[model samples]
Target: MSWGVRSILHGLDFVLQNIAWKPGIDSDLNVWSTRWVDGGMPEPVDFLLEEGFGFMKDFRIKDLCYNGGGRNEGMVRLIFKQESVDKILPTPLISTRSHDEVFWPFSDEVRYTVKSGYGVIFGEFFNNKGTLKDKERLNLKKKRFCKTTLWKLPGPQLWKILLWKIITGSLPIGSEFIKRNLGWDPFCTLCGKELKEVETLEHLFRDCDVSSRIWFGSVLGIRTDQNTFLELGEWIINWITYLKGQKENYYGLTHFLVTLNSIWTLRNNSIFRGESFVQKVFFKQLGSLVSLAIKNPVMKITNDGEGVFNSNDSEDLEDELNCLKDALLVLVID
Candidate 1:
């Protein structure tokens, strides 16, 4: 096929064509080449005249290397090849972990997952301590939180949890949400004292003296200062590590998740609704969920909303505040 300067730089030619060529901007190659040729003139005006004239005839002196042919063609080919090669280089890849994964892309949850799962040497999944095998490790330690409750479903649950764990990483590193929020001094909604940063999830659920006085007392019957809320997975990992010899308590695991979820829900309601952040309210919610869990421990869930709370769990639903007392009164009637 016949080739020309336009075809030699086809892609660049297309781009330049679209750009609005203003007079001052140097789009005029005739003036540019003429100036370059005049400035770069050698001691041979007679040689320049002898060469066949073309678009870049003055600048292409190097291309006419053939004894019989002119140097103008050689210079044109050299410049064209150099410019084309410069444009041919591949573009650098610019992507994020979230673009391919199912997590909230910007959150700080990935660090927590890596810190918890790998400690320092973030490596293959299977090499880790738990059921996560190396083959499953997707190096998703820094991805966005795609979903939680993946285990409650099926297939590639580990990857889903890995993603969710990253989202949970956004949980304030310190226990104090108010302090973490920056700017304003975040006072406790219940008691208007400035909160400390290290008072995070486990603190709110288990360790915070205020929360401890309520839910922990009602549920585990503990009234102590030592129990803090560990990230649920971390807490489980610790328990599994400690109780390695004992029979696995899968039921206990389910119960623990339900209870924690209940407590977090209550905490949010109390903070946002101006509802009393009292221990009694938490106990009431805890009691209802516990009672339901006791009766229907293996509650199933499905994507189409087919199997959420079991039918039995729905039978005795009552106001969380009055549910325990309401059940007791029903027993009295019977």
Candidate 2:
């Protein structure tokens, strides 16, 4: 064969070996030979094979399911051993009653793409035991989280992009500039000369005295310096995910994003305009920003005409307002 044709054949062989059949109504997957199970093994081991069922070796996956697309549990239990039956029983059948699809198992969407294919190739060639390394796995997780959760967050598009930059270390912070050898000083302008902390995303957003005060004084009352997370990106993901889970209406998340945006705005104002951090002014701006977010058309108001952003009870609203009042007391004390 020609070299180009040989290469194509080799690629085709690799694809065939890795692709799996998603069970559908018209599945043509062989009961014995197809790698449709989770462990990538073919169904029905040699020891599990009964002499009487030798004639059924050529049967398709559809033969084990009912016409209405439910599994034939009785027949499956009788024909296959418990191990094979265990694997087959949990395999989800497509609800659409369509033809079976061949899918790449590694991707989130289960469709073959050049990126996933390249990842598979890289894992096989460079990784130990054909698995992704820790860094690769983390990158994959971040990509998935961004696609499914971060990008879908309710806010202005610019806010989401800013968050993306922060998590990906793409924000033009001083530490990032130093890493790129851009001839910029890495010391935080926000923290001043005496502290001289490096201006990393984590330090600027979470560890700095200014930022920590804002977080502690906010309605969420988060103590930014107390977290155990080593990385800012992971910390943001974990906190945001927890915030999202706290309320279906996303009150905690909205407050978090608004507070974060306000902090960034304050940081910029300090750097560009030589503005000093004022607690009263910062708290006022934060309260207004959060209020605006609650009033935004995208935010769902409660049914009782209370104009509350989330589905939380009136008691929760009272508690939040009381927290805000307490936060304002910090301005007096400072």
Q: Point to the candidate with the largest lDDT.
A: 2
* Candidate 2 per-residue C-alpha lDDT over 1-334 given as tens digits, one digit per residue, 9 for 90 to 100: 8999999999999888777676786688887666575424444545446464467867888888788667798988776666556445656566565777676665655567778778777664225544334455446546656876776676555568888988787888888888899997778867785687888899889898888899999989988765534477766776675565443444777788877776777777667677778888778767776776666554454432122245356676555545544442332222
Tens digit per residue, CA lDDT, model 1, 228-268: 32343433333322222122333343344444444444454
lDDT of each: 0.35, 0.67
Please report the TM-score between candidate 1 and the true structure: 0.35
Model 1 stretches astray by more than 4 angstroms? 1-167, 172-187, 190-199, 222-224, 227-233, 239-250, 294-334
Q: Which 10 successive residues of model 2 have the least lDDT summed?
A: 325-334
State the displacement of the C-alpha of residue 159, model 2, in Å, after optimal TM-score superposition: 0.7
Candidate 1 lDDT for residue 59: 33
